[model samples]
Target: MTAPDPTTAIDPVTAAVIQGALETIAVEMGHKLMRMSHSSIIRESEDFGAALTDPTGSQLCECRMSTPLQSGPIPGYVRHILKVVAGRGDAIRPGDVIMHNDPYGGASHGPDVAFCVPVFHQDALVGFSVTTAHHLDIGALTPGSCGIVDAVDTYAEGLQFKAIKVYEAGRRVDPVWQILEANLRAPQLVVGDMEAQIMAARIGAARFSELIETWGLAAITAAHDDLIAYSERLMREAIRALPDGEYRAVTHLDGYLDDPDPGRRDLPLVVTLRIAADTLEVDLTGTAPQLPDKPINMPFEGTVDCAIWLTVRSILLDSVTFGHIPQNAGLTRQIRIVAPKGCLANPDFPAPVIARFCPGNQLADTVMKALAQVAPDRVSAGIGNLRVASFSGLKDGRHWVHMEILEGSYGGRQGLDGMDAVDTLYANTRNNPIEDIEMHLPLRVTRYELREDAVAPGRWRGGIGTVREFTFLSDGGFSMEGDGHSHRPWGHDGGADGLTASVTLVPADGAPRALVSKIPYLKAKAGDRLVCLGPCGGGYGDPLARDPEAVLHDLREGLLGPEAAFADYGVAAMPAGLDEAATRAERGRRIVSPPS
Candidate 1:
């Protein structure tokens, strides 16, 4: 007998084909999650990501819809499961589906639920399938999965399923159901959502196994290895394109630990990404201090995971031409991330991190700035901040939890303007439909329209912001916390800063009032209304570079306001032929040196 050559086992072409198949399978896996999920967060809001991994737990391929926010943690989560299973001296038999939510246990965010299932071939563990979904209710002390800050420990956050086997050998465990029901407020929905996650993992595992069988394990493994290497190469090429140098940027948060407060001035977070030929290094040594008492504190490891994924997602989402680049461990072969211990990104276990994105978003902005130092044409000015809106109250005498999240505008890039009212780089979830929300719950959506006069004016105007108003049909009860209202999204180059976010409350009798940046809890009564808005993305270039006709078209199409058409853009809305000449003359007369 002679040893076989790996190349002979699986050619690179076949391996590439298998990789494509796995990518498609990942999308199907997500569809299963959407169909089976119970909460609006996972189903209607589409806040979940799915991926395929090797038996030892390395990410191979994922879906585009998974978004930039979720790519970092799946592999880490799988590694944790493998460690736990190996330490127990027990084999991961088929049907041994385990779930973990502890942010310390490899979760990107607390609400993101990770489901792991091991695939077995010939009575041996061949590979693993992992799925993570943002579950709305984890039986937390708060109404939704946003954990309560008042709780003394994790128990108050919700039921903890620590490496607990929810399903065993392809069968649902009885005790698991009892335990889940005992903790979660919406027992039926929570358990149903979990089942949906299991179904997704099962589909992924089955499809992966079929590929391995058809192509043989050797061929499949070779493809996996080749794809990983190819991804690393492509990323290195991208890195090498940038001149070897150090680039730095910094961002701030409204506040880390305060509820119903504007937040302490600004919580600074500095980002420094070094590109040296084919390698990149990201350091967060000067980041802000972790909030010892706030729910915004997340394990530093989770932060590192999120940041890396954010960078990759931004690059890919910004351009489809970059799709050829594989997003596996190889892509980060030249990347090194450092976050000082006890900082916001990496902290001790059980640190309250319900609002991880507050600082996380800042980290992303800083990273973009660092990238822009070298690749200005490749990056866009900051856009409206992204936030998940939480709404929970009493319905029909029972406690109910509902959350509505929004994706605001993104600033334009070098050539094109940013997209409007869309999910930023961090998340790719959908907005819950007004009809779905009103019909299923006791709330009414009075006004859900784009907020005018919210765009940052420039040669190419930034994307417009959005405004939403909700009327409470039942008693008042709910609270919210998010960013971008106080610290507006900054424009790059010559673009101006976007509008600040706003939230207002219309009382049954009293005048409407402005809302604080973050809210832990607020008492409510029937007929009270809640309105929230998102900021606009920043703009690029001098306002003079914009086309006058484009500005008029925006006015005609409702994308731009009349005031913007005249003031920021310098386009006059005059009457017909004379108007065009007058507009030009007016623009010429007002010409002055650009702002310093």
Candidate 2:
């Protein structure tokens, strides 16, 4: 009998089952990668993403633990690979695994290596299984291949691969492997991670093939289409709920690389969000020009993808029924982005983009600020900066590179305070455990604790950031990529702004010195200590409006000090049954003459 039309609708129960199965396969693929990987970045921190896509390169299901920044760009990476293969007249067959990590070629960044494997059944390509992970090194001037804010161009950043077949016909490509092994300083660790990525893709492909067999190719394809359509419908309905209008927000970067002038900050990122009946558009027209020598530029595709993902998460996913909707290409169908060429959002070719995550996260924050005007109930205040630090040097007579992404605070919302000591916004990776760091590298965690007075006080207090101090066991080179050292996270409504991020270097015998937000490279002695104070999130409403009991609870929890409780929240402590009269008088006085 002829197969049913793949585009036709499938039953709801079967469609849900297929969706769950696809997600399960993706999760299994992630587990396999982490279990088999050698590097602590992948195995311990779990900085990786996995997904299953249809033949046309649309995502069907992604691993639940995948980073939002990494997973959203896989479909674009797949399409770019397909375009290159088609240009060269290359055939994509079963057992073929492709690898790429070129930012200009539609990758998120150079360090994030991606692998795509085609799943075939009945001698026909049905879908793809893909994985992307941040490798420890890729033959860059710096050890981690990232955190080099002063990188003048892409050449100084790291190796760039444009859609190359790493495995053909189930056989490893020796030349590609040799190139990778020769380039990276940590060849064994890097190659081991690559091998794990390949294995994950292969396992995903095999499981997907089995799924196709059990459900039949036609039924599987039908379910995929149905699920995407359902997601699109839900997204459109969510968009329709917002009042149709144009909202604009502008935020600035703190500073650029190699600029000696302390007051020299980059131009502001201007985002104009237009909300129509059932559609949304993000226009980055008046943004700053691209910086050729700094690693702050961003690719156009990446910028668009980031904007779309932020919009979906803030608007559609925030809805009650749409909270469980599948995230696929269809959800972005109603979204449009216009980022002019040579702008900070869409930079020109060869511009260093190793530190693009700073601007990318800023773009998300700008979008949130714009949406807050129309959708206050659905939006939150600004979060912390994106901080990634890399430490490298000679250890045991072998070159070593240890990279770690620090966690920051999340912004406060309507009813709840922001999450504390967690990865905020676009980042979804876990903090590297102190035990893992000490075990893998020559470093010691001296102090890791929550900053006591760093939270933004409001009716619902903002999340507090951490204060981590690391001491090198040996002389090493350190690099940092981050932002928001000067400007703090802005609160919404009548809330207060959050604390800014800061870093300091304290030598064993010398005095302490302050460090910039982005540092190219710094040499440290064996006894040197690096103190990183993360940025706290912004509050949601006025602190004076907070309940007295809530303020007392914050004081009891140590999130707010006793002095701040009396000053910010107008709450005073007394032995007599609660000083309610003094608190009321303090609040009334603040209402008449608010603190400037």
Candidate 3:
């Protein structure tokens, strides 16, 4: 393919068509990766990302199936990859597959590794294709990646792949592959998943090259710029429609509740949104200081920025409101993020960050809470935070790692009840199948159900969390990283606050023990079991104003007990149904008494 003349004018219809072609290429990449993956985390949970970017690392398109945390950081990954290569006096060559996972550089953490493939047309570099996924084991100190919550420094977390070339000039880097296989616990599985990522990225690169060939270089470039501009215009108009003002919100994370140091527990996260005209600035001026030895600090470029951008995009330019706005670099052009160095959101170099996922999600929720002040109807109330547990053990003298993302609930919003047993905010990953767990590893899913009688009460009641129990069929070791245990999810308006999460470790013979939000690795017997209770979301509106019929329905469904409905919703319930006159009288008496 050759570059066409620069003077030819491209029309809008061609631009829209080109935009669609780019999106199609990304979707294809995601499908290919999932089919080729070895671990259930990527194959079934869909905790991976695929995207295309310009030479300068501006994201052109992304796979909708991937999590925001994985795909949203592609642009950052590219810029850092290019910079690292350049700083080392190296260059990105055709057929070169580069690996980079520097949390301080552009990666969310060490576990979420990225693979990049540069595309060339007629010896001229046009763009690059990239894929990122959370590997089951990145040769961390422990057997799994997600539960390395006790690392005191980056070096202790795991291997840091900084701009290493796994493939150069279309030839395999044998030594790099050998190093990875030697260090990783599950070499066959981890390396296979990684190779899958490379294949998917190469497919994207080929598709992007074909796009340049089909539309001519000149037309493709013009259309790309036009689509970016259109997205920017839509964002500007949305910002203009909002009542411009400063919105501030404060939230906390349950950091190291078992630790002796008081500074590590109950960490505060503050967000101040300065919305003026068409631009938004997220200032993290009062967030908690980074823990010198904790792995929960968030990376500024990858984790923090992704949290802020994804939250604002979902709220302001939601698909329901403006339809499918192009997901590209221009959507983030008008927004600026600022987090002071040494804070939890923008930790300094060498600070541990393996367990940054939950904190980053909380930061996103804080941004949503602040914006709810201006866009009440468009936003949900406080959201239930997620939890991760790494279940690992030995089977026939071989190691097995399984990371489970316990589902969190959604807060109630205008005209709708919160969603139940779902991943919230930036951590959008599906639950691993029970069959997959049993077939591959020596584990059993003893129980799985929704939390009974734990619903948050409101006009639109909050979503309920789930109850999951896992039993070990063999001796094993495991760890955990999570939040929402100490502080309850905050409620909006006059709604009731939500419930916190709890984890219990039950021995086959001994009594059960309560575990904190974050736990280090511990040995388990053959019959050991873990019972996880996901956090519930905060409610919305006044519970007394909730429809009497809704309260009766909840009672009939057993979502809430009769005592809860009578006390919280001020409803008088009968065996048959709601008693209208009795309910009204009860509400009036409750209003008159105003329970203290």
Candidate 2 lDDT (Cα, 0 to 1) = 0.83
Alpha-carbon lDDT, every model: 0.73, 0.83, 0.91
- Whole-model lDDT, candidate 3? 0.91
lDDT string for model 1 (1-596, tens) is 12236555666677778888889889899888888888887788777778988776778788667755554678777777777767888667887898876677777666677788887777877777878877667877677775243444444556665566788887878987887777776666777888899889989999988877887776767777877777777777888877988878877777733455444447777788887878888887888776655666655555556765566445633446665656687776677888887777776656567667546665776788678778887777886777666667665665567877766787867777777887776666688898889887878989888777666766667887777788888874676657776677778888887777777888998999887667666777789988888788888877766778867777766776666677777787632312577568768877876999
Ranking by lDDT: 3, 2, 1
Residue runs of model 1 more than 4 Å from their true location after superposition: 1-9, 147-156, 256-264, 316-318, 559-562, 574-578, 590-596
Best by lDDT: 3
**Each model's TM-score?**
0.93, 0.96, 0.97
129 Cα displacement, candidate 2 (Å):
0.9
RMSD of each: 3.1, 2.7, 2.2
Using TM-score as the measure, name the better of candidate 1 and candidate 2.
Answer: 2
Q: Tens digits of per-residue lDDT for model 2 on 1-596?
A: 12348455589899999999999999999999999999888887778889988877889899877787777788888888888889999989877899988888778888988999998888877778999998888887877766888887988888888889998988888999999888888888899999999999999998998898798887887777888888888778888988999999988787652477543475588889898999988898898888877778887775446655755565557646445777787688888888899888888889988788777887888888888898887777888876889899987777798887877887788888888878767777888889989988889999999998777987787888899899999999898888888888889888898888888999988999998888878899999999999889899998888888887777777776767888888898532334788888888888876588
Better of 1 and 3 by TM-score: 3
* Range of the 10 consecutive residues with the lowest summed lDDT in candidate 3: 1-10
- When 1 and 2 are scored with lDDT, the better candidate is 2
lDDT of 1 at 331: 70
Per-residue lDDT of 347 in model 2: 82
